[model samples]
Target: MRAGVRNLLNIRTRRVSLAPPGLPRAFDGFSILLLSDMHLGSIPELGPAVVRVIEGLRADVCVFAGDFRLYAHQSGPTFETDLRRIVDAVRAPAGLYGVLGNHDTIDDARLADCLGIRMLVNEAVSIRRDGATIRLAGVDDPHTYRLDDLDRALAGAPKGAFTVLAAHTSEIAADAAHKGVGLYLCGHTHGGQICLPGGVPLLVSTRSPRAYACGEWDLRGMKGYTSAGVGASIVPARFNCPGEVVTIEMRAKSSRTRPARTSCP
Candidate 1:
């Protein structure tokens, strides 16, 4: 257990691809930095480690999957200070987007807004590049709060424009797929937080399928990737599942594809 606690700083950068069919040519090579479940105050020192990794990386867009603070309804100077530090270190030219997790509150959303993270609570935003636009829709925390409205979040998306839904948990995956979503990005289980060998998880907290609880998964052709996350929850420790900062490259492909591959650095 002590070793697992010390492994909290072993934050690896996992690289994968998101090549959902019908992706616009403009976004063929778009890169996204996915950060999630950063229960910040759980381990104070984890902040600088994350910042260091962010400083050395760049992405077209950065998405925070939520759980900014360690506990729900708990915020203080330390949490705010650490949150600001981590957000300020991001290097996404397109923008920083986020959704709230079970551990976050409305005030936490407001705090993220103050830090320039566009919190998409039951809303959507469009990202344009070279005359092509892709929609990013995010919902509220669906694990504990269950306040997400998929229709409201995806209301204005055009007929066939590729849409990516960012929820804190993958519980809404089936609904999103039914609604024509092309890609889904989320992180809530922390990859079990304490896994056995080969990174096999002992428990994935969400009620979603165990398949969608960790890495890349396909639900009826819609692609999704659940981050292992950058910080711990429940306790500041990790086992075989080292926390991760995921970088995903979006490609234009058909044929019900899987990610191009995963590389570690």
Candidate 2:
């Protein structure tokens, strides 16, 4: 999942197949759209950019992990407007699901309600499509408001249902894998905004250093891709890393083996 930012600019509306080779016949690929950290108040243009991406991609489900707005002390209609623009632009394939990120203040709560987004606050919702049942769960921003209880979020889920977990932090993958999640989508690291010599980020605002950083990584029992995020943070500059909206095609992994494959944003 760690690729040069220059490579992501080449991303267009096309099927970049991610189905691992040697997949069993039991499952077909699941189409998923992943976008995070738009920071709408900071980068207003990001809303339309994301809408265009949404229009271009043909997907089964879409996930916006978190950080809808930049931190604003004077929260009011203007802040709500910024949040509304971003949320309204998001056209989820199935539905728009989200959590809050640290930069997002109390304004996020009202925005979540106003935008009609299905805010998942440490809870899960089950939905069915094409005869497949999926368990979707999301947690609040762990930084300012942490209510991440993987067990509680996933309680009573059907034993065989496909599970997707969305969070703002990539570290949640460790717990997600232990909870038997099939996929986890997160965006906190801006793909190492200032990439280092080996494409590593110099500074990160996340609670924990990004282990997965930006791009795909496989945990013990789960697989996921972390978006570099659409907007900026802190200094608002990107070097070797370009922001991205990740499109992932998920095929069920076999219990017997992990297939070798290559993926991009």
- Model 2 Cα lDDT, one tens digit per residue, 131-156: 66778898777655676677778888
Q: Give the top-scoring candidate (lDDT).
A: 1
Candidate 1 whole-model C-alpha lDDT, 0 to 1: 0.88
Model 2 spans > 4 angstroms off: 1-27, 72-91, 207-210, 254-265
109-176 in candidate 1: lDDT tens per residue? 99999999999999999999999999999999999999999999999888997898899999999999
TM-score of each: 0.95, 0.79
What local lDDT score does residue 231 receive in model 1, on the 0 to 100 scale?
88
Q: In candidate 1, residue 54 scores what lDDT?
A: 85
Could you tell me the TM-score of candidate 1?
0.95
